[model samples]
Target: MGEFAQILRAWRDRVRPEDVGLAPGLNRRAPGLRREELALITGVSVDYIVRLEQGRAVNPSPQLLTSLTRALRLNDAERDHLFRVAGAAAPSSGLVPRQVTPSAQRMVDRFRNAPVAVAVHTAIYELVLWNPLWAVLFGDPSSQSRLERNVAWQHFAGSLPVTHTPEDDEAYSRDLVGHIRAASGRYPADPDIPRLIDRLVEASPDFARRWKAGTVGELRTSRKTLHTEQVGDVVVDCDTFSGGPGDQTIVVMTAAPGSEDEQKLDLLRVVGLQRLGS
Candidate 1:
């Protein structure tokens, strides 16, 4: 096997199933995660994982490597090593990194039992980290394609089924466009930002119009309503905390204490987990 394949196999064997919120299933031959499990957590296809482990897939993108690093719970040194072995450069300091930092991952884990739904998104609003509650409130982001995962893209492309008044919707659209414009300025060298802008401009007339308008803004605390399959209209307060290399925003959604919305949120947790498990 090549260096990339060998290292991947070693790391996969080192990681335990329970370490990444997975159960140790019956009649297992190995103690660590299965290739399928790794593929699932890393958001890649099983065939792709097989090809990667067999050294057929060479030079995986930084984004794909970052996902694998997080899924395997690799430390900083290991992550860099994996990049090197895969014939890719390690993400440099001061540039916008697609990978969520260990500290940020820990923070996300800490809110596991909290009622709030928390998620981290890139400056361009691409989701990178999310809690179970976030999945419960807003469908699982894993189901979305890489391009469809961005908030701005979904909003302009009309993929997200958010329920809001016309005024609120208009304001939200403006905010999304402004945020992307700000991200483009902050990370001028990021190729993904420019590519995303070009694609949106080509595919979405509304997005093209907004881009030309050039109104830069930050996504801040606001109140909005969401329409879910299991639950009806649920109004909640949304807040954004910015950090990380790419100015990633940690979005937290919460309802007022002792309100009806909180009750619905509680029910959503149970129903959502059940749906996910199935």
Candidate 2:
């Protein structure tokens, strides 16, 4: 089978069998849920999912595709890809997996000051664009691996250096990782996703632990504490937006209680000017 078809089959085949509360019977041979059980969760016949993986059926109805996504516990990126294949389009051939639309890129550029990042709808938030504001907030040096750039990896590893206060850092980290984890359930199969996944699972014990939980979440606004080294501890209101197509997202961050971070942001223009002068 081609890489695309193989990736789909492998995604369907692996599941946190325990995550679904299935028995870990001695007879079980695989690491994930059984195909029949998946049918039960998604409310589709297991045989049908089998057909899609086997390349026996193309152009599955949208409704049926949706049902399979629910059943397979697919994430946003995976769901969009499933829709494409089901709709009879060939999978994209980029060496790295991305589905960013021009509209989404424009949105990222528009938020020049806001730390904006657009990701695919799947568990692995595929990266398309990240602005200077994001680089500043995350302490992201110029070099980051294609996989490390994904939000999911950053959230779990806490490897990205964002200037948050001590009191707020843990809470902020937890919510970010949890939300990304929840988002993954929307798409299960997009080629180019699993490579980084395998690498991450091997490199980080924390990520490997959480990944198996199969938690699902929708992007929503909420209050959280963030600690900026320059501003001390402050509350921030975070809002997330769903994309028009391809399940992209826009996240905007603002300082709450009019924190000092706001002052720093207001002064950013001067910094830009001084750098230009020098």
Candidate 3:
């Protein structure tokens, strides 16, 4: 095997199945991730993984490499090493990073059973790393495309079926655009932000209008109404906590304790798990 292939094999061997949210089955000989498991988590085909590991696929794109880095749970130094071995450029500093830090991952894991929905989002508002309650409250964000996973894209693109007052909806739309503007300003050279902004401008007239308005705002705690198919309208408080150089935000959704909304949320949790299992 070539140097790149060798390095890839070593990294794959270092990642435990449980580390990436998989159960280690009985009769398994490998200590780390199987190639199939790695491919599943990375959103690539098993055949592609095999070709890459055999040195037949030498030039993986930066995006593919980034996804592999996350699936393998590589640290900064290791991620850079992966890039170097792949003959690709290491991700530049100050880019809108999608990789959730180990600390941030642990933070979300701690809230596994909390009676609230929690998720981590990139500065560009890409949804990454969400708890099960978040799936219950917001539907399955995992099914969304990379751009569709973005909150701004969801609102402006009219993909998410959210219910709000006309005035509040307009305000929320403006706030989302403004937040994206702020993120763009903070990370001017991030390649993905420009493409996303350009696409949003082309796809939605509302987004085009708001982008020209140039409003700026930070995401703060607020109460919003969510409409679900299983339940009717659920009102919850939305809170955002920011971390990392990329300005990733941890979003938490909660209803008042002992309130009817909280009861509905509890029911939703059970329903969500059932849907996942089925």
The digit string of per-residue lDDT tens for model 1 on 1-278 reads 89889888888988887667677899999988899999998878999989998989988998888888987777778888999988889987545567776656766776666677888888789998888889877677878776877888778875665666788778888888998888888788878888999999998999999899998987767788878777788888988887554467888888999998988888887776677779
TM-score of each: 0.76, 0.49, 0.79
Q: For residues 195-243, could you state the per-residue lDDT of candidate 2 as single tens digits?
A: 6557667777766765576544555665555544544554556677754
Global CA lDDT computed for model 2:
0.54
Tell me the alpha-carbon RMSD of every candidate. 4.1, 18.4, 3.4
lDDT of each: 0.82, 0.54, 0.83
Once fitted onto the true fold, the runs of candidate 1 whose alpha carbons sit more than 4 angstroms away are 1-19, 22-40, 43-64, 75-77, 91-96, 165-171
Among all windows of 10 consecutive residues in model 3, the one with the lowest summed lDDT is 158-167
Candidate 1 root-mean-square deviation in Å: 4.1
TM-score of candidate 3 versus the correct structure, residues matched by position: 0.79
Which model, 2 or 3, shows the larger TM-score?
3
Residue 1 alpha-carbon offset, candidate 3, angstroms:
3.2
